[model samples]
Each structure stands twice: as structure tokens, then as C-alpha cells.
Target chain A: MKKTCPNPAFLGFLIATAILVAIPGLSYVKQRAPETIIPGPGVTRRGSLSDYLPALKGTSADTPVFYLEGKEPGGTVLLVGGAHPNEPAGFIAPLIVVERGVAQKGRVIVVPYANGSAISHTEPLEGSPASFSLKNKAGETRVFRVGSRLSNPLDQWPDPALYVNEKGQVLSGSEMRNLNRAFPGKADGSITEQIAYAIMEIIRREKADISIDFHEASPEYTTVNAIVAHEKSLELAAEVAMYLEFDDIPITLEQSPKNLNGLSHREWGDYSDTLPFLFEAANPFMGRLRGKTDETLIIEGKDPYYLAAAKAKRLNVPYDEKGLPLSYRVARHITAFRYVLDTYNTYYEEKAIIVTDLPEYEEMAYRNLGDFLN
Target chain B: MKKRVFLLAFTLVFAILVIANGPAVPKLAEPVMITTAGQSAGAAMMKVLFTKSNIKDFVFEKLVTADEIEGYETLVIVAGASSKGLGAAGIDFDGETQRVTALIEAAKKQGMKVVVAQIEGAARRGTSSDQLFSLFVPMSDWVIIVRDADSDGFFTNLCEEHGIPLTIVEKSIEVSAQLNAVFE
Candidate 1:
């Protein structure tokens, strides 16, 4: 080699190749792949939102829908998540249902990402991380993105100076991008509005007997850890609340106001035959008084500011050192959903939706969520 | 070979320095002084004034006196100024007769550009006709109103009757552009 050494160019190429080879090995950090959910024995088929609304095809609005049919013919119910993607409990609780639930009497449909585009991006000014990961009992980790409350600006830009909702209520212009505010949406409207319209169409076409939209709110908000139901669904919601109260879960029941326009609970009830219910879990991460915003805060739900605020008796939800962890919130949502379903069955046997494999709030709190995840 | 290598290193350093220095320009300007009227009906509109356009320098303060007008080139007196608080402050309020005359004369003498933003919807509390006509309608050189014509009846009628120059802005972000058109 000494005698047959090539030109400097040859040596440079060898050195560069060596550097490139070393870089990959040195920089290789273990990245957990997205969780592979094993649909429970009840899941009959898997489809996409695009199947119901073709306009969503090939777009981020398109997402997976898990269909669980019972052995006997009965009414169908729909569960939607990720309407506001920042609320992880909204999406993850439904995912748990899809992965493990067993529909025994009626059909249960789940859309884990109701607004898929919202899940692709995070709020810009909020300083929120793009993604967080959780490890299951088998040491398999799943990563999920924390997204904005509104549709991605990239998908719909140039917000109107003022946005008038379907009810003719004027709101801040940026509110036009909020999927929650785009209910009873128009086919010719913006992408967010179309997504809303598509959801409405799905509910109307499916004749969903009961529709539940899962969400979370800041702990400081009065509506935190409550269930807001349309006027028609209030009695069932009250029954569910009473049941949850006996379990010491402490859930509040709110009646969706008549004047509030374009909200899912309001418009979904007004426009469709489905009984609309929206669940709100307490999320300290969404509060203004949270500490460093990281996966720890999002998953653990502990914040010193909230701790102080709790001591001052300012928070709407009770807070302790244990914090309102994701596991607890997710479990609360699952429990609420189960109770609502049970109550529906009691009141309207013809449209009853029975599902199993849902872990109780106590089990989730004690054993942790990792034990249940596949 | 050594000389060439040294020259290459020097050239790289020079290039880095040039890149780091960037283009020459003035430093970013400080925020402008903003004074809001207490009885005004446009908190939302005033909030937009901060977010709109490239105008980043806006400092909000409650309107005090003609002497307090210092550090601000423009004054925005929203609807209900005359009847609600201006009259209480000993300012003249004779329908549109005396209040507009005093406000216009005062603003001109103070070298402040007056912006009259039309009130939209009902006031959070209540308003008076004297406030609408005396303070907002005739005195303001520039008028900004919402696209919804029916939100404010008094302001709409006055603008229509007198043919005053009015800008219909839908989004609050447009306020920045409007301000830039006047001040920038």
C-alpha cells in the first residue's frame, strides 16, 4: 500500500466513506415504532373515513375506522377522537376501545383521528413538542404527535377577517379553522368545514343511535372533567353521571346551551337523529399554569403551578402530587363511555350498544395503561 | 502545496465572516404608544390593532389628557366616547353639534390623527346616541366599520348620510394594514 498509494483524492474518498459509516452507528437512537393495535374479538371489519366521504380520500382528513358488530342485529353507535388533537385522552381512549373492546350486542364504530390533519401538526406558539412516546408492558413503545386545536394552516390558509358559523354567529377569524366550530359543515366550504360536513353526513347515513366525541380541557376551566350533552341526551347523561358518582369518579353533567352555535354537541344533535354526547377530561398540560411543556407534563400531568393553584383553591379539578396522569384521564373517559352505553341500553333497549373488555377506572389507575395495551 | 493550503484556510475563514455579518440595516423599531378610550366599545378591535400588519410597536394605555397624548401619533376613539365618559370629563356633548367640533379642533391642535372605529353589536353594557354622534361620527377623519352593516345602527346611518370615507374590515388582522396606511 505504501508503494502503491493512490492520489490524495482517493484517500479523501476513503476518509469520507469511513466518516459516513461511523455517523449512522453513532447517531442511531432507539425510536419506538407506532403501536400495532390488536383489535379485540368484537371487531368485525376495519375501514377508513374516506369510505364514507370520498372527498377525504388521499387527504390527511382520511383516518382509520374500526367497526365492531354484535352477533345479533341492533342499533349502531359512533365514537370519535382527536377532534382537537392536543387532547390526548380524546384520541387514546378510543384507540384503547378499538384495540381491546368487544361489542356484544350492538355495533360500535370508532374513528381514532376524527380530524387527521389536526394530528399532523402542533400549535406554533404553544411551544409544544411534536411527539411523545409511551412504552407498553412488552417494552414496545408507541409514539404520537401532539397537534393543534385547529386544522393545519397549510391545509387551509387565508383565514377570513371574520368567521360566521353555520348559526350566523360571528367569531374571531381564526376560529374558521376549528373543526369543532365547523359542525354541520358545508360541502363547498373550507377543508375543515368539509371535514365537519363529512362527519355529519356519516352520522346521518349511518343513523348512529348515539354519538360520543371524546375531548379534554384545561384543568382551570369550569367545564373540565365534565360531560356536555345535547338537550335530548341530558337524561341519559345524568344517569351516567349518577352512576359514575357512586364509583367516586366525580363527573359533572352539563347541558349544551341553545345559543352556542356550531359545536359538535349542539349542531350534531340539531342536524342529526343521533344523541350527541361530548366528554371532557381534566388535562393540566392544557392549563396556562403548567411548567416545562414536555412528554412528562403531558403524560404525568404534574405541574408545580397547578399544585399551588390547587392549594389556593383556584382549580376546578382537584389536584395532588399524583397528578391527573394520562392513564387516569383515559380510564375516566373509557368508564364514562361505558356508563353512557349502559344507560342507553337501559332507556332504549332497541338501540342498545353493549361492549366489553373496557378496564374500570380503578384498574387503570392501579395497574397502569401499559398493562392493557397490546 | 503548503502555501496553497494556507490560502484556502484563509479564504474559508473570510467567507464565514462575511456570511455571519449579514446585510446592513437599521435595528428593529420600538413599539408605538397606543391610548384607548375608557368608554369605547371596541376592546376586540383594539386587540386587533396589535396583531395586524408589520406594525409591531403598539403600547396600550387608557386615554388621559391632551398632555398624555405625547409619544403617540394617532388616537383611536371608539363609539360611545362622548356620552359615556367624555361628558363626565367636562368635554362638551351637544348631540353632534358641540362634541364633534371640540374633538376635531382638539385633535388637529394636538397633531394627532383621529381614527373612529365603528362599534359592532351591542355594547357589553349600554351606549347613548350622544356618544355615537358627538364623539365618533363627525370628528373622526377616518372611520373603520365591520362588514356587518346591521350591527351598529347609529354608526351605519351617519356614514351613509354624510358619505364619510369608511373602510370595511372583516378580520382584526386588517387593522395593522389600515394603521400602516395611515402612520407608516
Candidate 2:
């Protein structure tokens, strides 16, 4: 039992390894804390996805479902956000709705984090900022994570060779973790599919008259600044688009192709009675021609590359020196959602879902986006 | 004073607008049959415009065929190609072209006025859309388009060459007012 002294270099190496591991480990754990959502006075009850599907109970896949039930009973309208957590406008718009929107008629159900697992981690190797902060109306700084578009591999491991979704559409293996492509999901499928199944359950059980999923796309994407609505929802979508034009917010109305399967606008309409619609706003930060990948780009949405591309007539949506800021994008989504409800009320007066207190587009875009947040 | 100059300038501009009111837009008959040449959402927007304009005697058939135009007095073909929309309608570009061509020919043979419109602006303009516009605009009796759609003066030039009456609206919503002026 000589008990020789430990090698100094080896000890030094162990300390270095510990410091390296601990630093990232702490940062990774910090991201697991979900963003805070304070439901407004219009929120009559709080629920979770587990309430619709018991299997999701106590799992990270489960997320909050805030219900704004009006005093007068009417139809249900489901609003989903954060389906792809990397799209910040999709997540932030619903947060504002839940914290500020008041349901004057029918019901409004807001799901700010439709895929909790996706918001728990950042995409690997993207060099994205982990979180961004905004100051609320109370002047308190609220920090929100900029998570990955796909579910964490830790939650659902081992991507398949190819993903044939529930609708039999073939996609790449990595899309197995994409909740948007997992609609009408199997009850015993992957965690992402389970999340989809739970959302589908909400739409089916709630007898939702209208379901809208907010999304954002790169400025160069063809679908940017458009509303993809199912055939059943086309008339309402068309009316809403016209109303948006009257408000000076020009948006394209795209009929959801029946051939495109497994999407919220497609499968949700086919599988359930809900007339589904999805909105996409142009985000320069998400464009392939973006210059810097950082928090400022995400918030400010200014990129010289996009400006050059716009000048070249290479981008889909209009781009200029003014840039499309996060507030404008969020305002577009919220305003479009409001119009959808208004149009629905006009067409289906008996099953109206009239909401109030939502921020106006000009006011929200002119002021800070966080001013509407709680 | 600056006030007098400003007032005089404003009056001069007003007089110019009143004097140079542009060419008269041709009156289109009611009982209009609205259909899509490329199956784009502009057809739906046209339907809304007709409804909002209080034009009560129009029928909107997104895929109206040649035979369906027999009873209509006017054929409004909204020309903007959307590959997605064509696919959803279970037709290719050539098939859509043939169908619309036949429908327009039938309408022309019956002495029905034809109005071709492009309302969605630059987003709906492309090679296929231009082809669709070329097919419909030259044969049309009148053309109505948003200013954004003719940024390069494509529609204006085509209308000019064809000697067709064209109404260029500043916005899609303005199309309703134009529709009212044409049909009222």
C-alpha cells in the first residue's frame, strides 16, 4: 500500500474536464425552466395537454392550455403557438394573447408552448443565442429561450431512416421530431407524435370551430406573409385577408393543398371538424441570406443580405432598409388571429368567438412588443 | 403668402384630376360568371369584391367550364397562376390553359363581355402567371389589375398592344369600387 501521490498533470486534466462539463451542464439545465406565462383576467380556467391525453401526464411533452371562456357559451377556437420553437414570433404572439386577450363571446384556447420538449434545448451547432430578453410594460425584464425547431433528441432518440407520417407523406428522418409533420399522430408513437396526438385530441374533444397555428418563415420562402387555409376554411380565410387589406396589412391567401399531408392546415381539417388555418410572417433572421445569427437579428430582423436580395428580386416578401422587426411580425400574427375570429363570428354568428383587448397592429408595431406582455 | 400658394397648388391639382379623369371604363353586364384561369385565390377575392360591391347577379364558380358560361352575360377570368392551386384543382398548367381558352372562346361566341383581372399583386406574378396573362389579356374585352401587379408595366403594355380598356387600381380593395363603376 504505497499510496503514491496522484499525478499532478492528471489532476490538472481532471479539474479542466470538470470545469468544461460543469459549465455547459449548468447552462443546459438552466434552459429547462419554461418561460413564464401569466394568464389575463379573461382566462377562466387553466388546463394541460394531459387533460386531453392522460399518457402525457408529468411528461415534458405536456404543455399549458389557457382557456378564455366567455360568460355566454358558444363555439371553441383553438390557437396554437411554438409548434416550432425556433420561430420566435409564433411563440411570442400567443403569449401576448394569453396575457392580454379577453374573450367577449364563445371560447378562446391559447397554447403558447405546443411542444414543450422543443423549447427545452437549442439546435446543435447553429451558434444561436440561447435566450433573448424584453422589458414588459411593468419595466421588468422577461427572458425567453430561443429553442430548437425539433424536439430534443434526449426526449425522443434515434431518428428513423425515413419518416412516413400518419398521412403517409414521406419526409426526411429528422422530420420525425418535427411536430408540424406529425399530425393525426398515433397514441403510441414517438414523443413528438404524442404531442401532436394531444393537440388533435384538444381540437376533436373541444369541438373547435376554428383552429389557427401561428408560424414564421424565412423572408425568401415562397409561403412568407401568407395564410395557408384548408379548403373548408378558405372562405373565412379569404374574408379575413380582405379585412386585413382594409387595415393596410396586405397578406396573401393561400388555399391549403389537399396533396400536402400531415400539416396542421391539412390534417387538422381532414381528421377533425375544425376548420384549420396557419399563418406565416417573414422573418429575416430565419432567411438563408441572413448576415449574422444573433439575438439582435432575431429581435430587430435587419439584415443587409436580405436588403441586397430584395434589390435583386430574390426574396418573396417585400424587404427594405426599414426591415421587418419582431414587433411587426408579432403584430401581424395577432391581428390576423383577431380577424379570423371576427370573420368566423360573422359567418357563424351562433358559434361566435369574439375577442377583445388584443393589441392593435399599428400600436404594437410602433411601440415595443413587450409592452403587451405581462 | 405661403397659404395662398398652397391653396392655389391644391386647387390646380384638383382641377387636373377632375379634367384628366382618364379613359372611360367600359360597362360590364350583370349576371356575371366569375371563374379562375389559373385557379389562384384572386378568384375568391373577386367573389368578395363582387359581394361587397353589392353586385347581386353574379355567380362564382372557381372552375367553371365552357358549357357553364351559356347563361351568363359577362365572364370575369381572374388570371394569376398558382401551382399549388392548380394541383389542388387536379389540373396542370396546360390543362388549365385549354379549359380557360375554351371557356373564353365560348363566352366570346355568345357576345358576352369578358373582363380579366389580376388582384394579388407582384407575389402572384411569375412566368406561369405571365403566360396565363398573355393568354387571357389579349383576348379580353377589358382588363382590371392592381398597380402592384404591373410594376414592370407588363399588364399595361399588353393592354396597350391589345387596345383593351384597362383599369389600374392602387390596391386590391379598390377593385371593389372599380367593379361597382363597371357594373352599377
Candidate 3:
């Protein structure tokens, strides 16, 4: 009786539970591991965020920075993407540059995933996809992780119910994990703050003339298709807007307010000599009017709910049956980035920064973005 | 060859006349002052405008006074009156108008070219900003305004009626380049 075999139904239940558990557990492990990024020919060297903040050594907060330097020394421009990793285009734009761009006369530093901790998990309660696939011209499909806006709770736990930022500005407790709100960050602070501190340190250490943070906003948000520039950067940002407009890409420039502390646009300019600019493109999945929270909506940016909202004149951006594609949004950012650098070179004759092999705006809009990747 | 020489001569003379006859622009080489009616946003913008362009050469004071106006050959009266800014400046609405009116008179008396810039957008339009707009737009030789601030075509129509050269901007951030042109 003591050596009786296990019941058939019980064994079956156990087997089913094991399969179900293993399926997700394996996926979780894969997501937690760093995503593969093949550096392009232009990349001379690479470093981790921990180089700026040694405390981040061997921690999940560490991220890679791809360096593309020209033979002749000139100015440096810092490009940050994936500050809120859920916005897929923000990450993809910098990723494309790191994989395809080569500097012609200046140094280019790119942080494709600024918040490494955020990339380890999907946003909670959003029913977001774990990953999305991009097909290249060679018929190979590359799957990229869709990440969260906040630092994963596993890495940064126990919110303070409220957070006072570096500027002594109050924010929601959960916003402590938002990298965008932790700029000019304190080293002896939260993980998010430590990451922010590392970024500021990088900007100052590299002597970045222009520091840019790329982002995505909901279509209904008024600031979509807009660039928020610190006062010192408004001239360069306006020039970027002018060129984008001439290329049939309509973008507005908003002067970042002095009272709005802790934002990348505001804090970076104040804390460092780097002129700060934050660019935003429209993402339906990031908006409240989204029809579904899925990879299709994130990458394709086609949501019928946003379309209806546009018809009602509720959306700040133009929305139609032809949804704002991921390719278009990423192209806008890359093109804007190119023009900003162009204008910066024109204005600062002594610190002229020239870059080549950037993703062309038209090709990125009409062709496949993945084709540009290495 | 005779005709070509004559045309070339005409071009040279035209350029000479334009430069000799005071630039057809208001006070390029002389000092200009960006004076706010009562708004700090306008003042913040003026500071940025000065830094970004040659406007710094002309921008003598961000917030000018009657005494300060005498030296500035061009006076740009940025028309936006924020109560908070006024309170910070230690002026009531009535006091703000009196000081602005006196400053404008002093500028005009000093033969300074006047431009009123309603560049703070619509939020500043209907508020006490309108009182400042009323006094400055008609008196100034030129008017600069953000497009959204003139939703009812008030600034445009006013500029038209007053025969003031109007500069309409799609964004306030672009106002700096225009200010450079205005000073030129």
C-alpha cells in the first residue's frame, strides 16, 4: 500500500502544471538576459554605463554605449534612446544608428537602451507582447524585446509612496523608476537615479555639445510630433524643425519651462554645458485611445480607436486608416537627429560636427528599417 | 555692354542708397531693448533670444524702464502680463500700465523704433495681456505675434488696420530669429 503508484489524474495534473510553468519560466529567463546587438563597422569601441558609475558594475542597470569616432577630432553629441523602453521606435532609432552609422568628422555616442532594467520585463497590466519580429532583406527575422516604462520591480523595489526628485519636485511614487524623471541624478540614490547620474556623468565627461533624448507619446498627447528644448538649445531645435518641415515632416518646437524640473530637456541643460533636447513621436499603444495593447499596435501604430478619436478631433496628431507606422516615427527621429547635428555644425564653426551614413528619412519611411541594421 | 554697365551701376547705387538711408530696417547697429509689460515668460524668451543671435548686441535690458528706454534705439514691448510676474515685480495691473505707458512714451520721445511682440500665445491673449496689447500694438511701428495668440484674427486685423508690419510665428521658439531680423 505504501509503494502504490501515483493516481493517473494526479500525475496528469502535475505534468500539465510543469509544462505550463516551464514555458513561461524559460521565456522569463530569456527576456532577463541581455539582448544581442551586433556592432557595425563604424563602431571602434564600446563601453558600459558602469564605466561612468562603478557602483553599477555587474548590475542590471548597466547598458552598453556604442562609439563611432572620426579620424579628425571635433565635437561630441550624446544620443539617448529607450529611456521608456515600451516605446519601441525610440530604441530602434538609436539601434539602427549603432548598427549602420559611421562618423565622418565627429564623435557619436549612442545609448540604445538607456534603461537596461526596463528592458527585462514588459509593462504590467498592459498585455504587451514579450517580443516583436523584424524581417531583414536577407529573409532573416530578428526578434526584439518589448520592454516596460518603469524599472522592473524585481530590481528596484518598495516605492516610497512619493518621490522628491533632484530638483525637489514631487512626483508619484512609481515615477521614481522613470529614467526621464531622474536626470542630473544623485549617485547615492535609487537605481534609476544611479542610471541618471551615470548619463549626466557621461555627458559631462565626453564634453557633449548637444545631448538628445528620444521618446514616444500618445497620439492624443498635444506634445506628440514635438521637440521640447531647453532655452540654450531652442535655436538648434528650431533649425531642426525648419528642416523637418521642408522635408514634409511637420514638427513643432516647444520651449521647455524652467519650472519643469527633472526632465531630460530641463535638467541636462541646467546641470551640464550640453544643450538638451527631447523629441517625441506618436505611438498609439502609448495613448489612452489605443484599441489593443499588442505588438501590432506598438510596431504598426494602427489602432482603430485612435482613428475614431481623430475623427472626433480629440487627437493632437493626424490619424487615418494609414496608421502612423513604426518606420515613420523612427525615421522622424533619425532625420531630426541628422538635421539637428547639421544645424549645430553650421552655428558652431569651431566645433563643427559632421556625421555620415545616417539612415535616410525617405528610405526609412518607405523601406524596411531592419534592412539598415547589421 | 552699355546696358549691362548701366544696370550694374544702378545696383550699386541702390545698395548704397539702402545702406545710407538708414537700412529700411529699424535700428540695426544701435542698441535695442526687450522690455516685458509684466510677463516673465516673455523675459525668459528675451534672454534666450539674446544669447542665440546678434540680438545680444542690441538687447540692452530685458525689463526696461523709462530711464532705460532713452538709450535704446529700438524698443520691443513684449505684450504679455502675468499676474504672478506682476506680483513678483511688485506692480499692480494699473501700476504696470502706467510704467509701460511711460516707457513707451520715453522710447518714442527718444526716436526709438517700437515693436510689440505678443509671443506668449493664447493664454496671455485674453488676460490682462489684452490691455497691454491695446496700448502697444497701435503705438508700435511693428507687431510680432504667435499664431495661436490671435485665434480671432485680432492681432492680424489690428496690424492691418494700424498699418504695422506684422510677423506671425507658428511657435514662440522661432521668435528669436525674427527678433534678429526686426533689429536689423
- Pick the winner on DockQ between candidates 2 and 3: 2
List DockQ, one per candidate, in order.
0.01, 0.50, 0.10
Best by DockQ: 2
CA lDDT scores, all candidates in order: 0.70, 0.86, 0.78
Off by over 4 Å in 1: A1-38, B1-184
Docking class of 1: incorrect
Worst ten in a row by lDDT for model 2 chain A: A242-251
TM-score of chain B of 2: 0.87
Quote each prediction's TM-score: 0.62, 0.93, 0.78
TM-score of candidate 1 on Cα atoms, chains taken together: 0.62
Write model 1 residue lDDT over B5-118, tens digit each, in one string.
553454344333321111121122333444334333243235434443456666554344454555556666554442323332334334333444454466668666666664
Candidate 3: count of backbone clashes, pairs at least 3 residues apart or interchain: 0
- Per-residue lDDT over A209-232 for candidate 3, one digit per residue giving the tens place of the 0 to 100 score: 989899999887756787778868
Docking category of candidate 3 = incorrect
Among these predictions, the greatest lDDT belongs to: 2
